[model samples]
Target chain A: MTTIADPKAPRPPKPRPARLTTRGNTELYGWVFMRASGVVLLVLIFGHLFVNLVAGEGVTAIDFGFVAGKWASPFWQVWDLLMLWLAMIHGTNGVRTIINDYAERDGVRLALKSALYLAFVLVVVLGTLVIFTFDPCPSGSPADLLPSFCTA
Target chain B: MPDALPASATRKVPAGTLYRGREGMWSWVAHRVTGVAIFFFLLVHVLDTSLVRISPEAYNDVIATYKNPIMGLGEAGLVAAIVFHAYNGIRIILVDFWSKGPKYQRVMLWVVMGLFVVTMAGFLPRHLMHVFGGE
Candidate 1:
């Protein structure tokens, strides 16, 4: 019987794979962050949902005045702010992974990731600003433009 | 089944016939789907919530549109997706980081699933109460 060559036999040294050249444990840390942030998001998102949709008059209670009242409290403000940041980053990273997996061409991957990052930055910045800088009652605004509680 | 097949037929295995029914594969699929769902929801959530920055009348009118019963069911679905995604995400993290995690990955999946059920059982009743109990 003719003997076949062993594929597992030791081979000559070759050049290092290019992937090893990339920087440190960023991806590893990101994986960890996804889990840690997920736990936090569970609490933050559910709390937000519970308060907005369940407590008191449920969905009908979530009027402009309702939001104004909630944001007036430091607790709600911080909770929302944390939720905004965590969810945005988590979602962005998730999409980035998907893009990397599906976008075979380097140019396409770069374009898609760039767009994702831009959207992430825009939403997070705008959402954070709206959360912290929101004024239930704007100075000199018409009474009709304000929430009922704001006029009161 | 292989024995019943003719030797020629058995020798020529069909292309693209490999079944991917592993727990890990299913978990990855769920993670991707749930991740996309959450991402899309975030987009809508940000847009709607930013209505607060606009005039109160605009914000109130937009929110008022979400008061329908159908929206309530949608909210429930969102919660379910979040719960499953979060639980599975934790499992993935453990598998990646813990030295012994890969060996126990299957066990961890079941654990995560169990926790998901328990958490949902606790939250869903309260949510339904608020949904159908009326104002």
Candidate 2:
């Protein structure tokens, strides 16, 4: 029987395969994120539009007084809170993917992303505080400036 | 369930620590965070605005509630969220369609920072005046 050469044999290992030249599998994941986040954004955005623009009196009915009314309830508070958290995460992730795909320099990537993270944290923290602490009325307010319901 | 969200399917395969590939991964994380924040604001705004349909009295009552100091803070927060989301969104759009992706990255970041500075500058003072009185 003729002997065959070992293809599996490790030789010089093919010139050590160039330094810092490896294209890792990170991009595949970014592409997947865009598709996923896009789908969720579609739902969140469309649902938001339909509810605000189509339901009830439509666009004309919107105003400052209208806003004060909804925050009075716990159900709506929670609904809004969830929407805020989900959309921010989705949108931020989408942008982050774009940054990684394009930015070539390591320093630039780190700096850009650091700023993004800081902005994200500030918004999310502030938003959550507003939802739960919101009150429909306040003490010692001017009668004329306050909503008409205060007189009742 | 038909109402079940579609985004969940794609996110299931968490690109956890096991998959360290390239710089693109960071971008994905940022996109997700921004999307989630925007979604939250929309839901709240829609519901808050929905109060108008109930009645003038109800609407007025709700508006009055928003006068609380804590609620005022929240409003400030909402404004902050909107401004940041919009600013960063512009940056993302530029990178996507523009020819100057890398070149503009730094510029775009500064723009976002500038926007935050301007927005907060206007928003904070106005909010304080509304809540605590200018005097």
Candidate 3:
């Protein structure tokens, strides 16, 4: 029995397109981050080099005193804090890419990445702690060895 | 997959361009090498810098060792590596984002090298003087 079909049937909504990658935009974001961080790091690092290595007396001037002097200021504390975080993240990602490239064996790649992540976490955490918790002067230390401001 | 199949056994006789790679490929290799070197250096640098938390004397003592002439020259090399990596990194960014960047990547590499030499020129003499000047 052939029956005439109704001309006014409603249509179903269109299905979403299949994802090209299961991992999504993670790699893309990583790529973008490298470039973005690379730009900022140029300024941070170049200024760092200029002050530390190219300034008056150069590397010879660096010591506990010099470091304490710098860190005593909130400005430099923040500078170093930013440098620490950004440089580590940027550097670690670069290494991760290299590992993915050369470490053909699965287990080797996994082992290498494990070690890398462990180092990254350790360094970042320790560095952040040292920066925030650092003391310009100790109670019993000889004042001569410390930054002059520490005694003053 | 065959262990016995050395390329000499095939008829191909190394005819094309010898695969030494041009500017783009070499720049990529250089960027990776310098990046790895900088990564390792950063690790050591952070560790050494952290010595300050222990005691002022401890930190100073470790840092003073770096003032020697040998380490001074090594520092120069380190700076050189960093400069190259930095400039090449900018080039890479341009290549990725700028529409005309791929066409001029070779030129950009030259520009990177040019800038690198200038920066090192400004840096080395000053640093070497500080290290060896004995003032």
Q: Which prediction has the highest DockQ against the true structure?
A: 3
**Model 3 ranges with Cα > 4 A deviation:** A1-20, B1-20
The DockQ values of the predictions, listed in order, are 0.47, 0.05, 0.66
Per-residue CA lDDT of model 2 for B1-135, tens digit only, reads 457767856674555664554434444355456555654554455455444444445555666676667876775665566566555655665676579966776667777778789868855765556556442
- Cα RMSDs, all models: 6.2, 15.9, 9.4
| Candidate No. with top TM-score | 3
TM-score per prediction, in order, is: 0.79, 0.43, 0.87
Q: How does residue B110 of candidate 2 score in lDDT?
A: 73
How would you encode candidate 3's per-residue C-alpha lDDT over B30-94 as one tens digit per residue? 99999999999999999999999999989988998887999999899889998999999999999
Per-residue lDDT tens digits for candidate 2, residues A1-152, read 99986998776645565666648876666555554555555455446544543455533334444444566767667766776776666656655766786686999999988977776776666667766665455555455534567578
lDDT of 2 at A112: 80
Estimate, for each residue in A27-146, the C-alpha lDDT of model 3 and write its tens digit: 989999999999999999999999999887889889888999999999999999999999999999999999998898999999999999999999999999999999989778889889
Chain A only TM-scores, each candidate in turn? 0.83, 0.66, 0.86
Candidate 2: C-alpha lDDT: 0.60
CAPRI class of candidate 2: incorrect
Question: What shift in Å separates residue B18 of candidate 2 from its native position after superposition?
Answer: 12
Better of 1 and 2 by DockQ: 1
